[model samples]
Target: MAATVFAAQGASVAAVSTTVPAVKEHLGLSATATTVLIVAVALSAGAGSFAGSAAIRRSGPVAAMRGAVLTSAIALLLIGWAPEQATVTAGYLLFGLALGGIDVSANTRATAVEHHYGRSIFASFYAAWSAGGVTAALLTAGTARLGWPPAATLTAQAALVLLLALTLRAHPLPAAPPDPATATGTPPIDLGRGLWIRLAPFGVVLLVAYVVDSTVSAWSTVYLHQTLAAALSAAPLAYAAYQVGTVTGRSCADHLVRRAGPAAVIRIATLLTAAALAGMAAAPGWPYAVLAAGCVGLGVSALAPLCLASAGRLRPGAAEAVLARLNVFNYLGVITGGAASGILGSAGHFRLAYAVPSALVLVLLLTARSFAPAQGVGGGVARTSPDW
Candidate 1:
């Protein structure tokens, strides 16, 4: 439900951002002013992310998620009613703060759930998120057909969020008692450990996979419309295809992991991801783009869950902490991928942005032989391969 709210509001905001030129005309503002407004929104989102990390560390996930929902709803209300530039900017900042808080808190919750379940479920959870995004994208497109004003559309989204929040309260998982062996809180197993060494290649593979996913989600619509000369109405279909593929891929990931093991799965997925990116870069039309996007989604789908599951298997007692540390790198991928995409697009080489991550995946494939096999629960670290 929280994901749905975020997806709906995010899609609405994206639509508004895309129609900035028309909005400027309607509001009697220059193109420069509109560009500044959008930049302000992006900056506020960054600040919110920084602030939210601290908030999650201090307040716990349930409080943080609730705060994010309430704050976002209020911000949307302000955006709907405020006429002054200063007020609008402040609302955008608040909206960013809410998004940041939600992002951190939700992931933290997911990590906790995975630890408690004692199995791989992260990819399926993310698939649920993609389902939310798909719903939001469709709703936003429908609203566009109705000729709804941006503010009104956003306000309606806020109402829906509030309703969802009321219907579904935040439920954080209970923290388990710490085991003394791993309870020292000293960062579990240093980077030099054999297990860490063996896991490094798999980690690198997941990192590059995340970067590829982020790049596609952030830029595929624009790439479809601007670079491929697709109709604006059809651009979002690329994302829809990707989301569908992710959902489908995740549904079978656990079985695949059980049947083939993480090592074999990662190797095949990495190669497929490289091929998918190459296809996207060379796509000649919308149909090809959609097919390529689906391939990309399927190829990248199991990477994250496999990494998290591997981390859990590596140090069952310290799985949460290990996963958390790896998440820091995952976030770095998101940041760098977005910046790289922007730079490449500005230089008229947007395709390189996708291709570069493909190369990174290939590098991960070369290093794949080094990953340790999936050790069943209760198995000691001694039995794990030293290649990680």
Candidate 2:
């Protein structure tokens, strides 16, 4: 159920990306205005993370996830049918909030499931997310080919998200008591300095990962259409290709971690990502850009799940609280990448957008050692035999 809802969130992200051109055309929005609109989602999502943490502390992850999925559906509906820029902006804000809440609540639940299974299973959950993104990206392309307007395309996607929300059912987990700090409404940041210090490296990796992600997912279509001269129906292919690569990479991440270790995996993936970004920056045509985007996905796929999984281990009993704090970096990356890429793209420097982040990703090599002990075998987080 956790993975399922996460997939729905991925689908929403794809829908937003695929419809960017339509949204801009329909509302006559300037590129600068569009950048603000996208950044607003990240800022609002950061605030929503705290709200999700509070919901988890009060009613548990299951309940919080249900609320988030429902909110996502509503946000989609508003965006799909809105007649003006202001209304669309409102919808975007709501979507951002829902996206943030889902990030915290779903990841919190995912780590619990990972703990129960006693191995590196977090990557598989992200694999499901990428799969959903692939499906949505294709749906967008198909809808556009059939001459569907953005409103109709988004409305159909909204219905799919709503259907996913209705299927959610809670499964019982091992009985554990709630943390007293959470019960008393204390903020997650009030936790000791040592925990934040431990989170720093993982947080940096996550920040860089999302910078790569937001750049590709949020602006690749625009880059393809404007920079590479791709047709409307074809622009979304780059995003779809990226998600397909992520699905493939994440599907194999667990086995690779078990064989080579998390630090090794991070180091190798970071190098691949940096190279792929440079390739993307230099692609001479949309086809080459699409292929480079896929490589980017393959290389960056493991970094996020590993960063998150390692951070969860820092305070197992307070996973929700800790993950919420980590989300600060996540949103910061999104805002930075989304806004900067948009501004650069607006000024017709799309290549620079990808090129700059390539160097930023190389910084992750320094943080690879932080995940050396993230696996159970290394005496990081404890493991239990598969409950199944």
Candidate 3:
């Protein structure tokens, strides 16, 4: 049930991301305006993450999920039907708020489930997220192929999000004692103290991963259409392919960790992602770009869930608070990636945008050693691989 809600939010993300090009075209937004629109969502989402953490402390993940999911649907409707820049930008901000809330709550729930199982199962939740992205991206492509306007396409997606929001239900998980701070009506963890030092490594990895992610997810469609000369109906294929790659990589991530260890996996995947990004930047045609995007997804997919899992490990008892703060890096990466890519794409320098991340991603290598596998509930860290 938790994973399902998470996936639905993923669909929401894809719905917004894959339609960015259409959104720009429909409203006749200038490049700078488009960049601002993307940055607004990222900034708002960061704020929403803090709001979500507070809500989770007050109500619980289920209530937070319900509210966020509903907000996402409304945001989609507002964006799709809006006739002007002001209204559309407002909708994007609303969507960002929902996205951030869903993110913190969903990961909080997922980490609880992982602890209950006493295994490193975080990737599966992310795999579900990628699966949802694939579905929505393909849906966008299908609708575009059928000559549906962006408004109509987003409306259809809004319906789907509304359906998911309705289906969300609370389920029982392993019961744990309430946080002492929550009982006292105080903050869950002191974000200002030693927490940031412990979280810095995972946060760095997360920031880098999201930079790659937002760049591709937010701009790949536009890149294909403008730089690679793809048709409107085909522009979303790159996003779909990228999601498919993430699905594949995340599906195999846990098993790979059990076999190869997280550090080794991160090392190899980081290198692969860099190579893939370079390929994507240099692709001469949309088809090649689509294939390269998939490769980029495959390489980058495992990093995020692993980062979240590792960050949770640092403060298992306060996973929600930790994850919420960690989201600061996530949205920072989004703003950096989305705004930079949009600005560069506007200037016919899209290739440089993608290429820059290829090198920036190598910084992940410095952080790879930090991805220690989850020490299952009662089980100590896996003995097969030495802790980095």
Q: Which ten residues in a row have the lowest lDDT in candidate 2?
A: 175-184
- Best-first order by lDDT: 2, 3, 1
For each candidate, the alpha-carbon lDDT, in order, equals 0.60, 0.86, 0.86
lDDT of 1 by residue, 63-179 (tens): 666677677778777765667667766776777667656655555555445445444555666666556555544544456457666576567656755764565454433443233
Residue pairs clashing in model 2 are none
Of 1 and 2, the candidate ranking higher by lDDT: 2
List candidate 1 segments past 4 Å from native. Answer: 1-58, 69-100, 147-149, 156-164, 170-203, 309-324, 367-388
Worst 10 residues of 3 by lDDT: 379-388
TM-score for each model: 0.72, 0.94, 0.94
User: Cα lDDT of model 3 overall?
Assistant: 0.86
Candidate 3: residue pairs that collide: none
lDDT per residue (tens digit) for residues 97-163 in model 2: 9998999988887777776555788898899889888988998899988988888999988887888
Q: Least accurate stretch of 10 residues (summed lDDT) in model 1?
A: 379-388
